[model samples]
Target: MATVDRSTLAGRRDAAALLLGYACAARVSELVALDIADVRETPEGLLVTIYRRKIKTFTEVAVPYGRIPASCPVRAVRDLLAAMAEAGHTSGPLLVRITRHGHIAPPLTRGGKQIGDPHGRMTAEACAEIVGRIAAAAGLEGRWTGHSLRRGFATAARRAGATLERIGRHGGWKDGSTALLGYLEEGDRWTDNPVTGL
Candidate 1:
């Protein structure tokens, strides 16, 4: 599935966006705000540094290489950056804008200041659209939005018995326990359900 996306400019871009967004629990703004320089390779995994108003200084998060190579965030970002550099992009926003007509090519400069070219930092709406497109392409029959990644991550982690503090830190939320409990409590019904210890 992901192998096919690596075949084109937009495919690679969207693939990287999906995997990285899911793995990092990134907000759409934080996702699109990334630059080529924000990613660096580490001995264990790739470190992505995000600088947002909420996180005044900067935050570095490690994204490991998953067993599935095609779905690995580290590989996806590395490949995307390599493709971008090969296309002459040495700087600027990590995600280049794609047109409504679905065109992807190499015209963006380091800062995407090329005249009349729209390949630049993507908008939040565009990010949502990409997530929807990726979901549909993967044969998911329902609607999905940019927040799905974060939501899905929280659900998956809770199911794996991750503590609220761990989940909050992983998601870059200083105090997300209240919000997470709402999502988790419903699934954690073993304590109240009669089926437990039966």
Candidate 2:
């Protein structure tokens, strides 16, 4: 199974992006398109608003998990926010730019200002590349892409004893079957255990 360890990444932005993708079980497009305003901390947990480009609908998701490892999704998000604050980002897109040379920079406006770029969201291809790089750095082997993070989350959640109903709700799926077939295919490994037939 391919798992993401945010620590393996060289930059905070990369780590944060990977964590957001994994924890939210969100598409890379959603992750990169997310803005600081899209995140709202509620008493229940963190509420993330996902704007669907295809459907032209907004899906509000609540992440219930708390801080786990240093690379844990929640902690990683906190770290990402802190880094953004340090970079003088008060409100704007959550994920910014990280060059191939490992330099992190904010998106520039059309006027050439350093203000965050509304149109500078990462592409799906870039998202996939980021996932592949993180997986390789973490020593995981599998066919991984940006979609893998969402699949990985569903798979891991199910293996950890989360029911289909719960997983489905968490993923905002209309039905358990949809969640299983669409997002949690990796969880099928559990059904393949030789001991199960014994």
Candidate 3:
């Protein structure tokens, strides 16, 4: 997140997307489907509404202020919103494609031809590609996909002493989910290992 340049709108957008996604433990699909109105500022922090495609329902994710100001999700989102508003994009998709020349991409249209996805919003693939690009730019050597944010959130929360129920609820994982347990176990692997000091 610190690697992202705050001076540029594109950079701010990327940072906000990544931070918010991680903070909310949201899937890429839910992250990209977000509209400006879906995220609201609260006294404590942010209230984000995520649409679960599989469940056909919406879930509210709470994102509180971070202890570290530099890595705060709330600050990142506020900065992005301010930048977008200055660019005359006060509404519509929270994340959209920015052209090489540094302008928002126009809405897609099918001029008498059939188009599968006609909306101008960013796709899940595009979001993943952005994640990869940012990771590479940061000189991180790993296969970083958009899903990495969610996984990181789970691990970080677990390592920070968050309970399984809280982690599952925040990440929208079902109770007693094996996948959730896997992430928690992985988070615990380095700390207080059975083989440590043996």
Which runs in model 3 stand beyond 4 Å of their true positions? 109-119, 185-190, 194-198
Clash counts for all predictions: 0, 0, 0
Candidate 2 yields a Cα-based lDDT of: 0.69
**What are the RMSD figures for all models against the true structure?**
4.5, 4.6, 2.7
Greater lDDT among 1 and 3 belongs to: 3
Tens digits of per-residue lDDT for model 2 on 47-161?
Answer: 8888755446788887755556655566667777776676576677777665565444546666676564543456667777878987787787878898888788888887787
TM-scores for candidates 1 onward, in order = 0.80, 0.75, 0.89
Candidate 3 accuracy as lDDT: 0.84
Residue 149 miss distance in model 2 (angstroms): 0.6
Error of 2 at 102 (Å): 6.2
State in Å the error of residue 158, model 2: 1.5
User: Which residue runs of candidate 2 sit more than 4 Å off their true CA positions?
Assistant: 1-10, 52-56, 65-67, 100-119, 176-179, 186-198
Displacement of the residue 116 alpha carbon in candidate 2, Å: 12
> Which segments of candidate 1 are over 4 A away from where they belong?
1-4, 52-57, 99-119, 183-198
TM-score of 3: 0.89
Q: Report the lDDT of model 2 for residue 43.
A: 67
